[model samples]
Target: MSAAFSFNRIVAIGLWVVGGGTALFLIAPILAIIPLSFNAEPFFTYPMPGLSLRWYNEFFSSEVWKLALRNSIIVAVFATLLSTVLGTLAAIGLSQSDCPARATLTAILISPMIVPVVVAAVGIYYAFAAVGLLNSLTGLVLAHTVLGAPFVVVTVTAALSGFDQNLMRAAASLGAGPVEAVLRVMLPLIAPGVASGALFAFVTSFDEVVVALFIAGSEERTLPRQMWSGVRETLSPTIAAVAALLIVFSTLFLATIQWLQGRAELQKTHREE
Candidate 1:
C-alpha cells in the first residue's frame, strides 16, 4: 500500500525481466542449432528442407566419430576418478585446523581454473612434449585432470563449509581412526557434493577442446576436437548434430547435480526435524 514499497517492487520486477531476457538471448542460438541438426539437408540453416535422422546415424556409425567418442569417454572417466580422489583429500586436509599453508596450497591446486585455457594448453603441450607424452591418451587424461580437479576441490570445500569438526573428534573418541572417521562419517554426508564434483569433472573433460587440440594425438582425438575439425575441414549438418548431442549431455549433468543437491537438502532437513 505504501509508495516506497511499490517502487521497490517495480525495481525487483524490472531486474528479473532483464535477467531473464539476457539468459534467453544467450541460449537462443544454441536452441536454434538443435532444430537445424535434424534438417534433411546437409546444410545448417533456418527452416527445414524436411526432417531426417541421417546426421545422427552418421555420428553413431562413422568410425572417426566412434573413435573420438571412445577417446573422450576414456579420458573423462580416468580424469574424473583421479580428480575426485585428489580433490576430496585436499579439501578434507584444507578443512582441518592444523593444515599448513592451506591458502597457498589451494591456490596452486586450483590455478588451472584461474589460468586461461590457451595458456594452460601451451604450457601443458610443452611439458608433455618434453616427457614424450605428446599425442597420447595418458597425456590427454593428465591434461584434463588438471582442469577438472579444481571443480572437485571447490565443491568439496563448500560441502565441508558447514561440517562440524567436533563430529570427527567424537568419532575418534569412539575408537574410529582418522581414515575410518572420514570414510564412515564424513563421506556419507558429503557424497552428494563429491558426485556433483565428479560429474562436473567428467563434463569438463568430455567437452574440452583447446587442450585436446594441443596435446591429443590423431589417435586420441576427442568429440570436441573432432567437431572442431569438422567445422574447419567440411562444415556440415553433422557438426550441428554433434553440438546438439553435447548440449543434451551437458543438460543431463546439470540435472543430475540438481537432483543430488535436492536429495542432500532433503536429508539435511529430515535430520534437523
Candidate 2:
C-alpha cells in the first residue's frame, strides 16, 4: 500500500508540473507584451529605461485607433445579438427528440468552426462581393454572426442536456402556448447558457481578423485589423498597448463566464438535491 501510494503521488506531481509548464508557455507572450506596453523609450527591449503610459494615451487619442475600436464594438454587438437569437433557436430545435437529420444539421451549423479561417474568408469575400456587401459594416456583422453562432448552439445544447422537458408539458397543460412555455419556463432555466453563448459570440466576433481582412474595407477596420496593419506598417508600442487592453478585457469577460458557469452548476446541484 505504501509503495502504491508513493507511485501515485509522483504521477500526480508530474502531471501538475506538466500542466503548469504548458499553461506558462501559452501565456508567456501575453505576459511579455503587457509590461512592454508601458515602456517609456518606445521600443521592444529588456531593461526598460522607465515605465510610461504614452502608448496607451496614443491608442486612445489616435483617430485611427478610435475608429477601429468603434467599428469593433459595433460589429461585435450586432453579431452577438444575431448569433445569440439564431443559435438559441437552433439549439432548442436540435434538442427536440423527434428532430430529423440531427447529426447532419449539427455538422452543417458548426462547419464555420471546423473550416479553416482563410478558406471561409475567401468564400465569404466572393459571395459577399456578388451581393455588393464587400467593404460594408453590414457584411462584416453578418459574416461574424456566421462564425459566432456555432458557439451559442454548442453552449445552449449543453445547457439543455440538464433541462427537464416535462416542464414544457406542464406549462402546456396549464394552457400555455409553445412560445409561452419556452419563454416562461425553458428560457429562465437556460438563461446562463444563453448568456455564456452570447459572450463567446461577442469574443469571437471581436477577435476575428481574417474575415475582416477579406470582407471589410478601410472604413470598417476593426481593432484586430488595425493591429495587423500596425505590425506591417509602423510596428509601434501602441499596438502593444492595444494588446494589453485587450488582454484585460478578455480576462474580465472570461471571469464573468466562469462565474455564470459556477452559478449554473450550483443551481443544477440544488435542483438535484
For each candidate in turn, give its C-alpha RMSD to the true structure in angstroms.
Answer: 2.0, 1.4
Worst 10 residues of 1 by lDDT: 264-273
Model 1 has an lDDT value of 0.92
Candidate 1 lDDT, 59-113, residue by residue in tens: 9999999999999999999999999999999899898889999999999989999
lDDT of 2 by residue, 27-72 (tens): 9988999999999987899988999999999999999999999999
Predicted structure 2: lDDT: 0.96
Q: What C-alpha lDDT values do all the predictions have?
A: 0.92, 0.96
Error of model 1, residue 44, in angstroms = 1.7
User: Can you tell me which runs of candidate 2 are displaced by over 4 Å?
Assistant: 1-10
RMSD (Cα, Å) of model 1: 2.0
